[model samples]
Target: MIQFMLVDDESIIVDSLHRLLEGQEDLPLKVWKAYSADEALDLINIIEKTEGQGIDILMSDVMMPGMNGLDLSALIKSRFPELKTLFLSGYSDYTYLQTALHQEAFDYLLKPVDDETVIEAVRKLCLIIEEERRLKEQEKQNGMRLKQAQRMLNDELLRELLEKPLTPQQLADKEESYVQASLSVDQCFILLNGKVDQWPLTYTEIEKMRQREMIMELMVSMLQPQCSIVPYNGSRHLVWLLQVKRMDHDSETCDLPQLHWYLSEELERVQFTIQERMGLSCSFVISGHEVDWLQIGDVNRKMGELLDRAIGLKSEIMQVEQAGEAMSRYQDIQLQPQEIKKQLLALTGLLEAGEFLAFMNELRSFFETIRKSVFLTYERQSEIFITLAGLYLSYMNSRQMTTEVGMKLDLTYLTNFNKHTDWQSFGDYCVRLAEILFLIVGDDAKEQKQEIAEKVDNYIIQNLSRNLTLQQLADHVHLSKFYLSRLYHSQRGYPIYQKIKEQKLNRAKELLLQDDIKIKDVAAELGFENVPYFTTFFRNSLGMSPKEYKQSYQS
Candidate 1:
């Protein structure tokens, strides 16, 4: 029901309208009265201050002391645009109607006012206010949706820029409204050209490209090196600009040869895994020492020539001037079929058997030949990769990384997963990586285990209503209940049961802050049969009960 105020100079008129409005059922108006325009002014001031919002409707008489109804309506309208106004005047005065029009009054009733007329005017006023409120709410929602869509589009545009070189105008246009520019210097050009189509990862090129960027980002961060990477040559080439403090050629800090070697080694490792796990074929170019962005065109041309030569000879990494040296270095390498058999056998051995290290050495030797081969056979690569991964996992299991350490290899959850193709080599690489990871982390297993625990902690959140339990999760990952319990305590330094209780209490605090759901319901949903138990738990953890938490949010 809409609340309304009745104002007139006559007590009789005010009394009559108040009785009439109070008695009404359809409009169900809650009417208050004032005897004169001066009195009405006092009442309006009090209500606006106390309520901190305008009254829905103001009904005033035209002739009331010094200030008339039209004047009052104008003052109220200026302060509250949404407020509706009505005037009462006698004798059907044109002057009164004109004054009301100037005031932008909602409507005017001729004296003496009828009960039906008042009810209808109030009804119309209420509908107008409701419609305005709904429109404002819809506008707010539309604004939020527009913001979300804009952010998504911005992310997609940035991704596209990374995959291919855009002209200055295209780059500027893509980031026109969203990005802030930053300064950079030093650059190199890399051209990826070869029979890439022959690789098993035909469909995962974009993903691989993203993965490459990620490796670059992390590597650059560690090096504290200033570098900017842009895609060039229709997504088949890369332009990199790296800046550093000037240093002697022999200093590791700015030694181009050393830096190139380090980056090349890491890329080679990733490439090998991509082949073993994803069954993808790719070729890359590394700009020669002293090359800078100023030489991009020249480097690109030379890189293309090298790529063509490598494709002709069947190789993945080609140096335009150092082909003879690379071939000589790798020529004597051969497939270690015996080492391959040994690694497969070690997958069944225990951690204490020392077979894992031997297996790694064997793989390194065996891959020497395959690594240099231009015609990388996916089938052959996949078999070796799968066997190596199985062996790695065996070592991880023997060392109890999964059980005592609570470290599970979550390859799919990694952000890098979206950047690569689902190639056989990549798949094999992931499996083998997981295996060797469990073994390699053995050196600092405690620290690594703690990090993995933190990641899992973030995943749990404070949704106590969820069915998150150790036994359930253990079954999902094919681990025993005992192992899961021990690992949770060892790695996270907390009992599983305690973690669940803490999560539930946190959620209860969030619900209490909302002031919508009742405290009892929040308690019930967090697995508490009694509301008192939830209050006690919350009080214990936060030093205040749920009621106190709700008050803090309100205050």
Candidate 2:
């Protein structure tokens, strides 16, 4: 609502002007009137204190007895530079008031002016104020969008750092991404993976984000070190990169055993805190030794593997054994961890896209690589099986198809890797699972398209009188507007918006048949901007005006 203040020496002018603007429904005004400049200034302060708002527009007499309109305008302009100003004056006073009114002020109304002239000037000022407000709101929204985009970019880069080595150019450029992520390349650091245990499949994306953020904050507060957290997308895991050497003291670099013991002690505390405070348990795995940044991709992937296979316990803190010690036997056969995860992620993407042939081919190649390893052992096979099974189970849960898929296919491999004594046995099971997944995906696509089409048709029919856009329909179906448009066109054999116009035409015809319904009301009910647009539409479509259509229908 615009706060309008009118000031003049004459009581009648102030009272009449106040009433005229106060009753304008379109303007949505709250009017204030003052008999003198001093009173207006006082009221401005009082209203500001009481309402927490300043006058939006100030209309004052040009020639007053005491401090004239010129002095008040100058004060108002200096104090509230954003407030719009308009002047009221006679021909004789115009010359006197000329110097006081800035030429750029909102246009003035002359003395002996009609109420319409005063309102018209004020109306123009209101439009300017409203437009300014709109632009400011737009700027705010744009700023928020920019912040969210930057955050998304940071997340993507963080994922890259965990999954692959930086290119030579990135190192030469001295990329700020690692710095922004608080990972120091010149120093030793530890990577920790935490998996929030037993996250319900129904927990939405937004809920998982909230929980991850909360857990991140809890860990940061307890650890009290330079650290950064990156939560895995579409999964219940969060990774933390923490500096190994605390810089608070000269002799504070953590020795290997001390660092391992420190991490074990601290992470258990963190886990206990989670169970007690948040009623959740997160299983964790931290690197056994301090590692360099260049090996982060491999270290992170190996840590995740250690956490993936827990046969007997849940929410336990496990550490990767140092590579030269317990890991020596498997080191020769260990595939590049980053490459393994990359192909695994691609496998999930292929499944999502319903590329059954590609999925099977990728699955075959992945298992074959594991089988071909001369040093491949039962333990290594168990880890590979667990990771692959986790991926399939996660996909099924995300689609809420776990129960349905389980009923048709044996999912025992997901938990019991020991049953599949050889890679070939497990590979065959995966192929069977892929066959079912493909069938469901194809059928699901057809079902989804039909459901979306029905929803759009029903919405258009029901909300004929309401303004509707492609975005609204897309939002209802939780799809992008462009994708929804393409889907609708594909499924219904017409553009979605074309259906809206057609439905409006059909609804208009139905409404016109009722004699008591006015033509303009029919236009309004059909969501037309005005009667003429409706008339034009009716005549163009049916070769008759809405009135003509009504008359002919009555006959």
- TM-score per prediction, in order, is 0.26, 0.33
Best by TM-score: 2
- Quote the lDDT for 219 in model 2: 83
- lDDT tens digits, residues 184-209, model 1? 23223332222242333222343445
What value of lDDT does candidate 1 attain over all alpha carbons?
A: 0.54
Error of 1 at 522 (Å): 65
Model 2: per-residue lDDT, tens digit, 1-555? 888899998775677677778788899688899999999999999999988888888888888988988678878778778888788764323244346434346655545455666777787678668756864686596684574465576777777777878665765465576666555555566777876754542243344565676687578667755333333432325787666554564555666456667777888889989888556767777785667667778888776555443221246666666423434544566666566678788887887776655777788788667554433334655656777888788888988888887866668766887554234566767876775665456565676568778998998888888767665776676554445665677677767667887888888899999978899899898876678767876786788888888888688
In every candidate, how many clashes are there? 27, 0
* Runs off by more than 4 Å, candidate 2: 1-151, 167-169, 200-206, 225-236, 245-258, 322-555
lDDT of predicted model 2: 0.69
